[model samples]
Target chain A: MLRDFVKNIGYDDPLEICLSELEALLQYNYRISKRSAALLLLQEDPEMFELVRKNEAERAEKIFSIIEKIKPHYSYPLAYIISERRQREASRIAAAVTTVGKKGSLGIKEALSRAMMNPFIGGPILLAVMYYGLYKFVGNFGAGVVVDFLEDKVFDQHLNPVFIDVVNRFVPYPVLRDLIAGDYGILTLGFRYAFAIVLPIVATFFFAFAIIEDSGYLPRLAMLVDQIFKKIGLSGRAVIPLVLGLGCSTMATMVTRTLPTKRERIIATFLLALAIPCSAQMGVILALLESRPLGLIIWLSVIVGVFMIVGFLASKIMPGELPSFYMEIPPLRFPQPSNVLRKTWSRMKWYFLEVLPLFMLASVLIWVGKITGVFGFLVRLLEHPVRWIGLPSESAVAFLFGFFRRDYGAAGLYDLKTQGLLNGNQLVVACVTLTLFLPCIAQLLMNIKERGMRVGVAMSVFILFFSFGTGWLVYVALNLLGLNL
Target chain B: MVQYDKDDKKQVVPLSELKPGEKGQIAYLQAKGKNQMQKLLSIGVIPGMSVLLVQRFPSYVFKLGHTQFAVDKELASSIHVKPVK
Candidate 1:
């Protein structure tokens, strides 16, 4: 059977090659038929080789010699020769069996899609997408409108007081009451943050991102950013993780595994940590700066500027050949409402599930910290920097909350916002600092897991100092400019 | 009719519709480039080959058995086939 396969592949009939000497070759200790075993060997088929080696070791040696003689006849590897023969056979059949004609029209839609991938047309188009898909819709409408409805109407007026009453009545201890109903309470803060604050904002973000993804706009975004990305030593491919990091940096850190080179993955992980603000952070920042247009613009410029500058520096430090990039742009399909909804619903559910338990756990830790009076001590310790940044001492808690959950810290700022604690310049400074803050513990753990201890710890420490250092600089710059809210 | 049906399941297509990160098997390679297709062949993309679509964001990363290769989506769309079961 193996011998027959060889004859078929060698493109010759075995019967013609074998003659008077065939009987000797067939003997148990004789050469395993020359062309047949070599062809199977070229196919890298182990089973056939095992059978032939078992039945005729002596014969296999003789066949191996013939294969050695045949080897120099081709410049390429043997596997290439075998596959070229197979593809020729496949193409021949395809030619006979199928018909393709006049090709499909390369009409307006195709040309427009191509135009979108070019840097000149693509850059402004990307800004339009961010403005419409992200800023106006998700940031303003979802975080502003939807969150106001839930947090103000639903939680502030209805849910929180009721939970407060329940805890007050059921619990005898003042400490326990506060643990469940007081500041940083699981029900009052955690659940509220998840539902009232993060929910509407993320739901809208995922909806917008789904449209971009399903339309196959991501690859084009990659192409548009390729040159700028090259300065950071990554091809345009890093755009996927960077884009996704906006949704959740923790997941984006894990997705870094998909990058082609180790250098790209490290650069991506570092950038995600430094500049990309996840949805929760984005929602909070939007709320903070939405009232002050100048503040918002300044904050955006700083983050984007830092992302590029740091990326360029990392690219220079990291040594590797930049992998050439080629990505598929699926035809831009009109985003189906149902598919968009399903994707949004699923992604939101996944995000909520991953965060809910952690939020609950953070509440427990704070409860313990409060019980031990350690929470107060930590707040006092954080107050020096809070004051240094010109933030009110009370803002220390939000900075603490940031370490546990990056977005939760931002939500804490929302609490401060309602109290009118942050003026325009202060809001800008706070937003800048938080955007550069270390990723939440989840994303940090993922960074350590993916990039390992040395790379991971080193990155987090650099970011820790850099976040405060930059925050301090921004604070001074804003103050010196004498801009008042 | 096809669009209506695709609404229910994922918009799964034949190998010719392979995007980055999609997994499929090679049914055939139509048209030419028949000679230089050795890169695909050496990586085990001949007929009856199975591959996992790894990264579809920037390009297509297909892991054929063990070897990983990236190709532009256009080239991927050119390879016609039934998907892996």
Candidate 2:
């Protein structure tokens, strides 16, 4: 396609002379136009320089000297000067071709957008969205009602007994039968947890996220939190990944690649690993602490306090440039129903597919550990730390399960809570510890893959100690204060 | 004459100092950090470009070519502009 307006390549006389001189020296077959290639060369693009070296090997040195020679003529960087000229010409063309509508009166949409960005109004609006969309819709409706129906009615009553009976009748050997339908078996534990518990929570969270995202509210939310984020050594740009971490930290870990600086990415990753709980874990935790408001408050304060402290410390430790953010805030529009539903469906499908096999594998691993007595041994080892955090030794099983998947561990905690095994203070300590625990296997792999082995392993080791260390402190503090509920 | 020009240049302030709803023509962007300069330049915030301040809270939101960009105070200070009459 022909551009409507020509890009005046040389903004000034010296630039024009350099472009022509470099264009004449070009000998290679290039993908883009020679004009564009010459412009890139002037921008000091490394790839273009290599291409020129390979194609125009003899005159590559001359091209280099020309760039060097012109450096003295301009006070600014050559790249900046070139880009500035291009922007000037482009803006001129844009203004010439486009006719804007009546300007003067701010429309309702503008008023609404302004209100959403205003701090006093935006803060309350954010809380309202979280309360209605996340707490009521996702927590109560999806996690509480839907999960109860699926888990208690569908899987527990009908599916498990039938599967166990069938497996018992068909399989003669006890070990093989245990593998198929026993406790911790693939069908009984894995499928039940994945379908009944995690699925509903994840689906509702993704649906809520998609609606907010499509409405163009995410950027406004980013703007609202930019100040708080700056103190953590990140700009508003990091909000996307940080907010998305609540939906799925594994995915959010990968999204950290979008951050501008390595320092910002590392800090964001560490925080995500340490404090953020994905949707399924969050739903279960909310359900666990629903009755104990004080317990819930304590959990929130400790986790948020750790997030801020760790982020600050990490930013200080990792010396790099503070990230400068610039984002195009799209105009707010009513989310199209079809778009929101499609996005929600696609994300749910992707998440379900990624987790299904892993959950199954985890179940099989747990079963194997059980038969070999390794699970018992591991549970015993975890019991010491569990007790140290003021949790009953039985809660050790949940902490063990937590390593496989955060949601699964949270489910284990839920079971113990139902059995009336944990007290309020112990419950609060466990929740805080689990919330600050290491990222799930998927997130760990992602952290290693994104940040490499050294940093990734170091981060997990630090998180492990920090989570337990914080839990111990909370336990002692609770006892000392005599606030045991 | 030189003194008058110097005085006039002093009247131009950093983009960070502009009140919300103000408009300015970018005069000079003296970002000391290389990456910061590159980031701002890539977003078309060069000298001679014009921007309208959208909001000055939590962060500074501005408009250029129908697109709104947000930058914090530190980054905003790096951008120098002469307020539009």
- lDDT by residue for model 1 over A1-485, one digit each (tens)? 22323324333233224322333444443255644544555454567657657876678676445546555665545555567566556555555667867647768765676567655677788889999988889888888899999999999999999999999999999888877888888899888888998888888888888889888788767766765687788877788888988988988888888787888999999999989999879988998887788888899999999998999899888887554454444566778889988998898888889988889888989999988999999999988888898888888899888988899999888889889988887888888888898888888888999999999999989988898788899999887988775
Give the alpha carbon lDDT tens digit for every residue of B11-80 in model 1.
Answer: 3344536654466755555423433354356545665566676544344555654344545544566555
Candidate 2, residues A99-190, lDDT tens digits: the string is 99879888898898999999999999999998999899999988999999999999989999999999989999999888878888899999
What are the per-model DockQ values? 0.10, 0.56
RMSD of 1: 11.4
Cα lDDT listed for each candidate: 0.75, 0.87
Error of 1 at A258 (Å): 1.6
Label model 1 with its docking quality class. incorrect
C-alpha RMSD over true interface residues, each candidate: 9.4, 3.6
Compute the lDDT of residue A127 as modeled in candidate 2: 91
Q: Which portions of model 1 miss their true places by more than 4 Å?
A: A1-73, A77-83, A103-105, B1-85
